[model samples]
Target: MTQTARRDVDPSTGEAAPPAFESLDPRTGEVVGRHPIHDEADVAAVVREARQAQTAWAELGFAARKQHLDAWRRMLARRLDEIAGLVCAETGKPLDDAKLELVLVIDHLHWAAANAEKVLKRRKVPAGFLMANQAATVEYLPLGVVGVIGPWNYPVFTPMGSLAYALAAGNAVVFKPSELTPGVGAWLARSFAEAVPDHPVLHVVTGYGETGAALCTSGVDKVAFTGSTATGKRVMASCAQSLTPVLVECGGKDALIVDVDADLPAAAEAAVWGAMSNAGQTCIGVERVYVVDAVADRFLELVTERARKLRPGGEPNAHLGPITMASQVDVIRGHIDDALRGGGRAVVGGEHSVRPPFVEPVVLTDVAADSEAITEETFGPTIVVQRVRDADEGVAQANSSRYGLGGTVFSRSRGLELARRLRSGMVSVNSVISFAAVPALPFGGVGDSGFGRIHGADGLREFTRSQAVTRTRFAMPLNPMSFGRSKGTVRRLVRLVRLMRGR
Candidate 1:
């Protein structure tokens, strides 16, 4: 913990070694691990290797691939704590939270492996009356090679949403993990190698933005990216060169709605946790709350009381953790300052609560709906509570955002009714971030929050392309498709069609 970052030096030349990136411990600024800075050529070679391996992998069929994936899943489950410790050290999150995310990753891996066959296997499809002489079938085929650009937050769980599902669908993967968390990505790749030693189906390339861009342009069949919307646009641009499809999961200004008849205490607790947990680094974290006027005052009181009691620290008992990326501190502070300057006031922690590497929970009220704090994705431990006239107003406020990722609702009567009105990809009723825990539910969003899906049947299909096949079972007596058809034949075909339509 005491050691900071140190560069690799070549003893003979007395100079730095090849370019590389280091993973720093956010808590103490210590260099936890160092990885190579893979350039464009390196990325291309790795993708080529993966492409070569994909043929054998896809040929193994579903059962053999699942066996290997299951082995990898077991290894991850058995060594959960070891990997979680690395996650905790690199991300500055609590050990328990790291373990929780890893558990979800394992569950998703198992689900992807177990259900890939059922979801992707060729199935019989009925042909219409005109094509009754032909047998039709459809199946999802692997895209050969997939490139995954992972995120720093929830590094293991988030990228695995693409990696596991892709591998299960019979595709090889070339992962360019975030430079800030290369260690976790390397560990995952090593574990998979242990499970399936012969095939080099999974590869990890480590670097910064340039490396990610290289991955996008690499000769992979697809690229799955999880990061900011702006970066997603760049990825799409790069992929456009080769017409490679991309799946993007981006930022969100997610909101939580509180109805007039909501359980006030429950809503307050959810609000606090949703806005403050993991130091509010969650992409789908609740940044704003629109409460009904009838219960706004009491709900504000409860939220303020709970938020004040919480604090961020590196200790095991700390309610929250430090901001993983140091640069994001300025963004959080700027949002708070903007809120306060725009006639908004903090109910608990103020702008001064922003300590370096850590920020205390800040609950803001009276923030304007058009303000940056209200409309933008403030990915810090801050919450903005705005009052609304009724549930309809609350819905309107929640829906009025460019990013529709995930949301929550607290209501006794209209929980489901109001949830359906939300314009988000997923919504949880009477809870916070519950939809993400279920492996069956897809995790994705619409608009600027990014498109395509992960972590469900839909996720499995994202890494594949649908293919249709038809076989001629028998030939019809009427040779309608013949090139040398007589006028009598044409008249008979017309009569048959008219008779079929009850002419």
Candidate 2:
């Protein structure tokens, strides 16, 4: 290609500037793909086009939608490796990790498609004795269009939670992927089009925060966002101008609590994997551990030993990949520095462990409850372990955060009880991040973790509106809703109410 053809020309200068922006492979900072820098106008145009496409897509009904979704699933399954390569290239996650995410996403797609009809179809309800002549029914109807702002972490799986459910519920989607992983987003939209070629039922608009803001106000029926808590607030604010409803899955400082009777080896392994996977960029990645004093020493020894063996690199066998967002390395280092300054000791990795694009797993102990590492989301492959006098203190410290997202508890007897007492939206007993793999469960959080669910029945309903219909089967003998009711009828109605009330 010619030099000018490879570059973006400035409209006013009539000279070649540079391509708007590029999606880079985090592992080596190599350009994966180039995309246009879409703005508000661009986002609005796509949303309008999606709105036009939604009419026919919605009319296709549940069975037809399911058929298309199933076709897409088959395509993904058949070409799993190809797509997983794209995921790894753009996000720098291990190939196996990318495949695992796609596997979970496929399961969710099947669940949403198979259950949409049952969950959203019209259902009849018995009318009350006083209104026995009326028939009442309720159903969920599709919103015209939904705009999804997806995060870089688990780009396919995370957004598909919104995308698949929204389409199954009879709505079109206009997605705005994180600029850091636009290639993955574009690949998904392309695959969907191959499954259903008639229209743009799923469209991806690529750019930065500005593009996401535009989507929030693009007149879509609802917005589904997954990102930092601070950015989620901004998205909500932008949607507020147009009075649009939104579902946000934001940041979390998720914790894992270990009881005195817990399985120390299994808990330690889970803690290492949960906290260090994806270079610790996971929204639900474990960031803290509250262990009972009785077994704290053993637990720490096991976790530290496993954590030290992990290394972040571009190799195929590497346990973790580079940090997808380059800027986040600084944030991770800052949290580590703060933890150390607050009198915490790093048992595994420390300040010297963080290098550009990679951060070794760092385990801190004795971190104060008020320390930034404990209070705020570090979003790195770092875990802080604290010794608690008992399970009560462990639970109390775990619930002290403003974030109430996903958490884990390891206990033989008190797992369920302690899980119920924890303040998070979802928790796993003796397992780490297992709740996200189950397609039947609703996934979301409260407090700083954000609100509204994105999986299971609630997720399907999030993209639709509930509609109630009441029809008069016959004229009532005592019609309270009629203006032509006689005094005798009113007197009888009062008598019936009084008799029912035992007056």
Candidate 3:
């Protein structure tokens, strides 16, 4: 590729842009790759082609779509390792984590392709007693085209939760990958294009926020966004101007709870992994921990040991990878400073390297429940651990945040009950965010965490609309409001409603 090809620019505004942006190896400051993307018109052309292709693809029956999806899934499985390597290079996640994410992505793709027809097939519905002559059957139909605004963290796995389902439901997809990981996005589109070879069913656009805004404003049927709540609100506002519907999987201030009867070792292990994995860039990463007052000290000791053992930088074999975005270092440092000033003690690794991308894991204890470290989504390898009066307080503390994303709970007997009580989209009982591994469960959140689900049956239905059709069989003996309506019929309807409602 020429030097001009290795550049990044927002095609919408036509402003001078970065020819190349460097992706550093988190373990070392060495450059991983210099990536570039197509401009605004280029992105628009891709979307236009996808729109034309969707018309023909949608005409095909569900069986044809399923056949294509199966072929794509087989191709992806065969090349999973190649995709994982691209993910690792772009997002700086550990090799194993990248592979794990790919596995889940494949599973979701399989589930969506196999189950869309079942979940979305038309079914007979009662048209109400008043309209007994009218028959109703509701079936889900594709939405023509879908726009996916994805995040840098879990680039492939998270977005595919939406992308795969959208395609399986017969919608052409236009994706804008996070600026930090554009390569993976391009790779995904390229792979799918090869599998189909007939149409531009999967297209990608690369650039900064303006490119993303362009996708939201483009005449797509709906937008599926996965990013911070602050940015999600912007995407929603952009789509609102066009009267377009959007699904946001926004940021989360997720918490982990350790009860008095909890296994201290297991809880601590979960805490360390939940906090520091992917340098704590995960949306559902445990930002705060609430432990029973009785076991708080013991839990802290165990967590600190685990936190210290985790190293963020080395080579491919490193436990943690460096922070991919340069801007996050300051944010992570600010949270640590605020926690220390708020009377929180550094029980583990509070001090970061003060170097380039690599951020050390920091575990703080005695943090005020209302402190920024405890209340906010840090999005780094830092954790705030606090003590609670009991399980009730733990549940309350966890629900206090505006975000209702995924969380974890550890208890001996009441684990399941407490897990359900906490207001979150998904919960892992006695485990650390294991729901992402279970393809049967639905993922996504409510409130500031954003709406619309991904994964399972709900995920498959998100990309389609309900198409209701009524096929009249035999006319009812009593025709409503036709030539046979009378004043006595109206009175009887009111009496029936009152009787049914026990008025």
lDDT of each model, Cα atoms only? 0.91, 0.91, 0.84
Scored against the true structure, residue 439 in model 2 reaches a CA lDDT of: 89
Off by over 4 Å in 2: 1-19, 488-495, 498-503
TM-score, prediction 2: 0.95
Which model, 1 or 3, shows the larger TM-score? 1
160-250, model 3: which lDDT tens digit per residue?
Answer: 9889889888899999988777788888998888898886789888877878988887789999999988999999999999899999999
Clashing pairs in 3: 7-19, 11-40
Sort all candidates by lDDT, best to worst.
Answer: 1, 2, 3
Please give the distance, in angstroms, between residue 251's alpha carbon in candidate 3 and its true position after superposition.
0.9
**Model 1 lDDT on a 0 to 1 scale:** 0.91
C-alpha TM-scores of all predictions: 0.96, 0.95, 0.92
For residues 243-330, what per-residue lDDT tens digits would candidate 2 score against the true structure? Answer: 9999999999999999999999999999998999988889888999999999999999999999999988997558999888878888
